[model samples]
Target chain A: MSESVNQQPVPLHEHGQRRPMKKRLWWIAISPSVWAIHFLACYITAAVWCEKIGEGNLRPLQISVGIYTAIALPVIIWVGYSSYRNFRRGDPPVPYDFDDPTDRTHFFGFTAFLLSSLSVVATLFTVLVFVLVGSCD
Target chain B: MNFVPSQSALDHAGVGAESIAGLFWVMLIGGCLIWLIVVGLAVYAIVVPGQHDQKRTRMLVIGGGAVFPTIVLTALLTYGLAMLPDLQRPAPEGSQVIEVAGVRWWWRIHYRMPDGNRVETANEIHLPVNEPVEFKLKSEDVIHAFWVPSLGGKVDMMPGRENRLKLHPTRVGVYRGVCAEYCGEAHTQMAFDVIVESREDYDEWLRQQASLAVAISDEAEAGRKIFAGSGCGACHSIRGTSADGVVGPDLTHFGSRRSIGASVLPNNADNLTRWIAETHRVKSGVEMPAFETLAEDELRALVRYLGELK
Candidate 1:
């Protein structure tokens, strides 16, 4: 049964469309990359503000961090939503344990969904630091 | 080993330390509970009668591994981060400001008196109970950290930059403070006594610290002469007799301090004598040189003279 499923490969769209390996991997990696970039942006902004700009008013830092978080969160949510759609596309739904292109696509989609969820939480945590700590001190 | 109560953060005597101790308890209990839950889940999976359906297994893997940890850690992070602003809050305006500079293996302390004069002291710090004091911390050479665990959190003292830490000590007792940063050789020996007393007692102590040293007895007077002549004044300052050298710790009220050699040894005649004769043996890499060339009688007179400063 598994061999038949593997051999009958015309790229099943009912489950998921088979894309190039690089594109699939990029889809898996994009959410975390966004999170990493957001983390760097927030921290570097804070460091430069604290060092170059005097520790007087934190309004600018707060505004900049807020903007970065606002931008990053929506992107993460969109990625998470798209991945969830891909994960739920198959007739069998999740537990994509079959040895076929459709199952492989679902597996990658599930992995991407998990990564996006993790990145969303991590980005929120990064923003939480600025919310609690008002000053460089 | 002899127990030091002030060395432990759990034995909190100040407002800041109280919050820290509370946080520690919460974290510890939370961690234990999480560990038990995780272990119990594993045990349940093994001890169950039959294989769980795919849905249940997926829930066990995803919910237990990811969701559970995410929720627990997020809550913990929020709880921990909320404590930072209060911990970093500056003292109120016109409050008592104490300037402390971390030197090699010692602490140079200055109490900013209301009369615009700074009362310089070393090693020991006296604070009035029930009052918040702001410490303007600096490092004269390398990086160091001032930590009085019983009182509050530690603050780093970096060279060329001043960091401030505010502590409101509630208990009136003797506490120990140490350099939390590993500065150099003898960093372990860099410690001081924090004497929290009543307002009256604190004022009296400060008054005495501000006054010039007086050699009342003949032995003390002889030692004073020896201290001045032996070039000890070049690094140490005793306000009365012109032994003013800013390189080392101020010795105006050296005898009144609870410990000698930055708390490396107890403040006693034997320890003092030994410290003077073999400075490096007590704490290596200290800037002060040994006075091994002094005669036995001269060393005793110097020790006696310094002991009477209190």
Candidate 2:
């Protein structure tokens, strides 16, 4: 029942039925946006601290915090910006699905299995953070 | 303030390991207790199987295994967090500070003796027994870890940044030190020794080392000429004479220091002669080239001269 990979549906007032405007915006607000803000704050604060105090002399705790924020910031920014752009432009992106354009279009319209797979990737990232935190003094 | 084990690293390392050992005992005993209880319950349930619904079997297992494990882990984690604050000791004050720098396959030591006098040595380190010693660790190129198992845990020696380790070895003994970090091919053979001596003997040793730079017998003096002319002086250093080169270990206290070839060979005349004559033979991955071209007599004389530096 999936369409070609390149198809992206524009935001419409009615899909199967009429929906409220506020409800539509709320539905469109993905979790990555929240992640972006969280990471941005963590990263900016740490980068400023590293710059001001010099990275060479960081104590173990500071080093752990700095490394985690530094790595998370760029990846979050890149993913959040790109996906948010595509969602707005009616050209939503799907990272892995090349053939089914229908698979690319969903905001909440994500594949249950694909979203489940994100849990594995997210878990791996969390594990890295765990190890980093463990190194803290 | 240096990175190497300026007494802090050594003491903390010991404390850290002891902490780990304590936690290990707790886990082993606690986990076994939980395991026995859970297994006992399971066996009791199986002895009278089907009293609960067969469909409930999976749920029971999940609850017993997964949920119980979560409880066990949380308890352990709580205990660990409670214990973590005491895991490592603070850096010691009123300690001897030694700066140890690691190169390709060797170590360079700069001992800042009391009275602000700096005695540069390599590979071999001497400390007054029972004194707390601190090491400021650095690496000239690749990453290296300063590890002396009996004294302390490993601390990485990173270039540009200083890492500190503190050690208070109570015994008057010679213990081996090794490069725990894998930099290259010669990493394993990269080793040294910590020589802990009586306070007065250590002082006497230092004075002899300081003077050996100038006072050599005639034959050793002649062999010293051979050392300089052979380009060995370019990598090695012998203070108070013309053998000043930054590429290798400081040889001013070569005879007095514990080991030769970084930590490779025993500090004796035969090893010194073999090391100088065919360095690669004794320590295969060592950075210094073999001086096999030297005449046998010249090599022996040079070894004897270096040995006398003590």
- For lDDT, the strongest prediction is 1
Candidate 1: tens digits of C-alpha lDDT, residues B1-310 = 1234278899888999999999899899878877887898899889997968878888988788778878888888899899998888888888889999999889999999898999999999989999999999999999999999999999999999999999999998888999999999999999998989899999898888888886569999899889988999999988887888999998888888878888888899999999999999988998899999999999999999889877
Model 1 chain B worst lDDT window (10 residues): B1-10
TM-score of chain B of each: 0.96, 0.78
What TM-score should be assigned to candidate 2? 0.63
What tens digits encode model 1's per-residue C-alpha lDDT throughout A1-137?
A: 46665456534463345341213757888899999999999999999999899688998999999999999999998888888877666455557766666777678778888899999999999999998888887
Per-model TM-score, in order, reads 0.89, 0.63
Global Cα RMSD, each model: 3.9, 9.3
- Tens-place lDDT per residue, model 2, B1-310, is 1223223232332344345556778999889978897888778787975567756766777667666766676677667666543332334666778899988888888877677877777777777866667789999999999877656557899999888776655556666678887889888878877676788988887677556475778878777777777887898788777788998887776766656777666678888888877777787777688888888888887777777665
Off by over 4 Å in 2: A1-137, B1-17, B20-65, B71-90, B127-132, B170-172, B196-214
| Deviation of model 2 at B19, angstroms | 3.6
Residue B92, model 1: lDDT of 88
Runs off by more than 4 Å, candidate 1: A1-10, A13-27, A48-57, A84-110, B1-5
